[model samples]
Target chain A: MDGLKKHIEEITPITNEEFDYIKTFFKEKKVKKHQYLLQDGDKVTSEYWIVKGIFRAFHIDKDGKEHILQFALENWWFSDYNAFFSQKESNINIVCMDDAEVLCLTLSGREQLASEFHKMEHFFRMKLTSGYSAQQRRIISLLSNNPKKRYEEFASLYPNIMQKIPKKYIAEYLGVSRETLSRLYSTTSRD
Target chain B: MDGLKKHIEEITPITNEEFDYIKTFFKEKKVKKHQYLLQDGDKVTSEYWIVKGIFRAFHIDKDGKEHILQFALENWWFSDYNAFFSQKESNINIVCMDDAEVLCLTLSGREQLASEFHKMEHFFRMKLTSGYSAQQRRIISLLSNNPKKRYEEFASLYPNIMQKIPKKYIAEYLGVSRETLSRLYSTTSRD
Candidate 1:
C-alpha cells in the first residue's frame, strides 16, 4: 500500500485521507512462480499492479506457438487490457515468472477512483501516455525488421528486465530466434 | 470545432461553455499533398487531430528505406507523440498523402485543459486507453510475423483506410514485401 501511494504520488500527490480511501479499491494477492494470474478465455475483471516479482503475458496461436505480448516487473502494471477494459474474455494469459505479490483493481473500482479524484485521473492518464509511447516505439522497432537494433532498444529501455528475463523469452519478444538472441547476447556481453 | 467537440463527446459529454473554452486551446491548419507536417529532428510542439484527408508517418532507416509507422485518416490523431509529450526533437516524419486539415493542440494547452476540467482528463484518458490497446494488438501482430494474417487483420480492422492507402505503403506497414502484398491483394480481391 505504501508502494501504491508512492506510485500514485510519482504522478500526482494525494492527502493521507485520499490515499486511505483509494487503497480500499485494491486487494493484494500473492502468487507463486509458474502460477497463472490470468489465463485465456477467462473474463478479465481486474488489472494488477505488481508489488513484487515478475510476470509474462502471452498469446498462443492455433499452431501452439506462443507470442509474447509483454513482460511486467515489480511496480509495473499488468493486464489483458483489451479484455479488462471491455470486461470480455481474455485472449492472452498472464503467468507469474517469480513468486510475486500484486494489487488488483477492478474496472468499476478504477473508474470510480478516477471519477472521484481528478488527481487519480491525471495519474492514470500519465501512465497510459507513457505506455502508449512505448508501444509506438515497439511498433517502429518491429516494422524496421532489424533484430540487432530491436535487441539493443529493448535492452536499453529495460536494462533491469534485460538481465532478469530468460533469453528464450527475450528472443520471442523481439521476434527473433533463440540462436540469434544468444549470438547478440554473447556479442553484447563481450562489448 | 464541431468535429473536435464530437470527438470529445464520444467519450464524455461537455457543456457548450466548456466546449467553447476547450476549443480555444486548438488552432486549425491546412496542409497540401506531399507536404510535411512534421520532419525528423524538428521539435514536436503539437499533436494534430485530422479533420480531412490522409497522412503517413514513417521512419527512414540508415539504408534510406522507409518503414511506415502509421497512417492517419479523418478523426485520427497524429503526432510524433514520443517527441510531442516530451517536447523533444522528432525521430519520425509525418507527410500528408492528400490535402488535409487538422486542429493542433500544444503540450501545455493539453495539460492545462486536463487539469482545468475533470471531464477533459477523463476524455483524454479514454482516448489513450483505446490507443494503448490498439498498439498492443499491433505488437502481437508484428511479433506473429505472418504477412497473410497481418494483411487480413489490417484490412478487417480498417477497411476504409485499406482502400484509401496505396499498396506499397500498406505492404510497408505490414512489414511485407510489395510483391507479397500484391499477391495477397489479388487473392483477396478474387475471393
Candidate 2:
C-alpha cells in the first residue's frame, strides 16, 4: 500500500507507525475490465481509491439510457457517495473500464482514521475541498457551456481519461449525441 | 455573531472564549438587493456565510445571458469557491436577491481555526463532506433528469428555497427554459 501511503503523504506527513496503522484499514482488490464495482440497489459500504486503471460510475435512466456521472482513473477516489455516506442502497453502478486495482475503506474505518488522527482529518478535508471545487466547475459547465466548449473543457480537465475512455462514453458524459461527439472528435484530431 | 456561534456549535460545541476568538476572524457585511458581492474578473479572497436574505451567484455568457450557478439562502455558504480557494480572479458574480447579511472568512482565518481546534477542523470537514455529497447528486440529476423531473426534484429537495426564489431563477438553476418551468409550476399548483 505504498501508493496509499504516498497519496496520504501528498496532503500531510505521517510517521511510520501511523502509516502502518492506516494501511490496516484498507483492503486491496483487483478487477477485470467490464466488472462491476457497484450496481443499482446495492448498499455501498465502502468507498474505493483507485490504485490503477479506469472506471465509470453511472446511472441508467428509465428510458434505458446510460448517463455517466464520473470517470475515475488512478489515484482518484469514488463511490456512490450519496449511498456511501447515508448507508443506503445505491441508485447507480460503477463498472471497471479497464483492468483495475483499488483499495477499499469502509465508513467505520474512514471515521476511525479521522477521529484518531488530526492529520488524517486534514488530509480528508483537503481532498473533499478539491472535489467540491471540481464539482462546482462541473455544475456551471452543465448549466451554461455549449457542446464544443464542454468537450474542450472535459478534454483539458482530464486529458488522460479523455484518451483512455471511448468516444461514446465521452459523448454521454458531455450530454451530446454520438454523431456530434464524432464530428467534434474528428475536428479535434485533425487540429 | 450569535448566529455564527450557534451554527458552529450545531456541529461542535465551543467555549465562550473560543467563540470570541473565532468571531474576530469573521467580518460581517450588509448588502442591498441587486448589489453584487462578487463579480466576474474580481479576486475572490473570502468565503461568505449567509446570516440573512438571499443571493444568486451567476455567470454571463458572451451572448449576454445570465446562467445561475447557485442560490444561497440563510445559513448557506458560498463564493466562487475555485477562485476563493486558489486566490484567483473570479469567473462568476454573486448578487444579492434580497437585503442580506453575510460573514466573510479569509483562507488564512479558516486554516488557523482548523489547525487550532480539532473540532473546528472536523466541523469544516463535515460541511465539505455534505457539500461534496450534494454536488455528486446534482451531477447525476443533471445528466439524467428531464425538465419536469428536475423541477420536481429541486422543489422536493429544497422546499423552502423553492418558495423563496422566483420561478425564473429556479428555471435557470434547473437548466430548463422559463416557459417549461412555468408550465410545470402551474400544473403543480393546480394539482
lDDT of 1 by residue, B83-169 (tens): 888899998999999999999999999999999999999988998888887777777777766777778778865776766888878
User: Model 2: what is its DockQ?
Assistant: 0.77
lDDT of 2 by residue, B89-156 (tens): 99999999999999999999999999998889999998888778777777777878777667766776
Off by over 4 Å in 2: A182-191, B177-179, B182-191
Query: Chain A vs. true chain A, TM-score per candidate?
Result: 0.94, 0.93
Model 2 Cα lDDT, one tens digit per residue, A69-160: 88888999889988898899999999999999999999999989998999998998898888888888887778776777677767766886
Fraction of the reference Cα-Cα interface contacts (below 8 Å) that each candidate reproduces: 0.69, 0.75
TM-score of candidate 2 versus the correct structure, residues matched by position:
0.94
Instruction: Report lDDT (Cα) of residue B145, candidate 2.
Output: 73
Question: What's the true lDDT of residue B63 in model 2?
Answer: 70
Q: How many residue pairs clash in each candidate?
A: 0, 0
> Which one wins on DockQ?
2
Query: What do the candidate models score in CA lDDT, each in turn?
Result: 0.88, 0.87
TM-score list, all predictions: 0.93, 0.94
As a whole number from 0 to 100, the lDDT of residue B68 in candidate 1 is 82
